[model samples]
Target: MMLPARGGPEPCGGNHGSGRDHSPARAMREPTAMTASPQPPSPQPPPSANPAATPARAAPPIRIAIIGTGTIAHTQHVPVIRAHAGFELVAGVNPTPVPWWAEATGGLKLFSSMDSLIRSGMSVDAVAICTPPATHYALAAQGLAAGWHVMLEKPPTPILSQAMDLHRLACAAGRTLMTSWHAACAPAIDPARQILASGGVRGMRVTWRENVRKWHPGADWFWKPGGHGVFDAGINALSIACAVMGEPLFVTGATLDIPAGAATPCTAQVRWATPSLPDGMEGIFDWTHRGIEVWDIAWTLGNGRRLLLSQGGGGLSLDGVAVTLRGTHEYECVYSRFERLVHDGASDIDYRPVALVEDILSAGQRRPADPSFRILP
Candidate 1:
């Protein structure tokens, strides 16, 4: 199968340009004053994908809205937006009412739906969508239609075609559509990529095991059809693998251990086909491991050297020596790139990781496992 374009958010080690706009007026303008309405005018023919045709003038402290205000939004995105100097956390849109904690302390203007948020005429330059995998396409399309840059949570969407459509929509709208593959944002990834570039990969293996009950607690959606199950965490490793290899990776074969009643798998072993390592790069994902969560990827180079990324790519080691890596936290790194993309008027929607997941799930062999999960309401 042909790989999709690979131009998503750049690795954290690259230069994102000097964000040097000190425009006081753009900074001081409130969200309501940024745009008159959230509606786009009558659709013209899809515009050319050239961002330079009309240079984007988005100034720093970008007015951004959060779409879902769920677990990721509250813990990762909200804090990052509040802490980042280049973003202004304007408001949030959720179908359910805001929680008491958010209502009391977030100082966030919450709307029950996108239409409600639109009716309020609040303006924003971008939106970070932290909703479930299934809702991503519609919400992101809405964000693009409203003339806002979009940041989708990992997997982008459960379906590949939906993600492709969103990419086209973003390109035609001349807006940034970023996939929030935060695992690729780890500080050690770029260094690992640089080291891997020095030699060919002889072999690669990924072992990602965690107790889904312990990590996910009450997230019932995890076992549903659209909920990626084990691949939800497995794809993080793949993202890092793709980033470190500096190329796309394809799945050759896969074996899925699905629970008896669950729609998704609980464990998966996927074999990857790559040029350098034809019969190599195996990834094992299991959500039923009891002790010591393991998330690591090890590689044997053509030269006599070994590289390892442990703790979900947070730590790196080479030849029994720990290579010191430095950078901002992963989510912060993610927002920094979004800030740059918005300023540059560009979209970064890498399709390889999602494609890998879709392929593995769609084509993998399936076996029944003990149904140890209870799907919550």
Candidate 2:
């Protein structure tokens, strides 16, 4: 059975600014695992009188652009990109004109389409695609083909093949392709992973519940085909689970509660095949729960102790006692990792979570349920 709600989602912590700073000191806060607290920025030395005494200048920030200026872009991506010292917000691509985006991006040159952005001869080092899942493959492919690093929002693509194709393209192009699983970047994730890696994971359960109206409001795309519906939020749990487990997840069976006239399920109950546990791992994903949203995972160790990761991997507790954690700034960690990947000419591509969702959807049984989602026209 699913556990009771602990608390609602906690706001991520990071530096807040217009993202106009070019100094490395203004970069995202880097936090270590477990009790490793974040260190303060180093103090800059005084300027030397002799020209030769001055140190070499730091590398210029990566010029990046945002595609699809919608809610996610406005709220999460834009703010993070702007606040990141390693990136400079240079341009945006959206068919519809957003009057406020000009000021938000510091009067960046906005293009009506990706084609226009590419045709304009703009210098861009990376592109963050925050568009819908169905559009991810195409946008990411275009970005990679253009010789720019690509950062894709969760569920990189609706299917596994498309995601793999993008990975191949990125590899051939030698560009960094990051499938951004923000939940995996949460503070408690690494700590939880460390504990699980040490062994003794007897049993685990995932309960992910949320009031869709509160978080997505009138976002009708979530109910459409390829929208992923409840899996959109549920995938975060899967990502956290796979990351912390340090192993691939296999779905034994699933039961889906799809709403009437909707192309996707509003709730899902999935069972996983875990070799260690007799009952294995069970997951409950619901989009209709009211009050405080719950995104929690609980594990029972063989020693009779309990390990809980709550608030979508933002907090960790053992035996009901909370542990002090840092690096709760998910997007900051995401951008910081992206910076490293680009610098190292490497890619971070993990499709396990998406594969798990696909497996559940493929082998799950479906039944009609009452509709609570407000499908915007």
Quote the lDDT for 328 in model 2: 36
**TM-scores of the candidates in the order shown:** 0.82, 0.83
Candidate 2 Cα lDDT to native: 0.74
State the lDDT of candidate 2 residue by residue for 1-377, as single tens digits.
23235744433211111011221112323543322211110112111122232223376888899989877777667777776667889999999999779777788898999999999999999999988888899999999889999999887888888987887788788898887877777777767876776757877889999877767767767787766778988998987786677445678889988787787888999898765554667999988878777888998876778899988876789999996676435665677778877887877777777888888989999988665443442
Query: What lDDT is obtained when candidate 1 is compared to the true structure?
Result: 0.71
lDDT string for model 1 (183-207, tens) is 7776566668778878778888899
Residue ranges of candidate 1 with Cα displaced over 4 Å: 1-60, 100-106, 371-377
CA lDDT of each candidate? 0.71, 0.74
* lDDT of candidate 2 at residue 273, scale 0 to 100: 72
lDDT of 2 at 45: 18
Ten contiguous residues with the weakest lDDT in model 2: 37-46
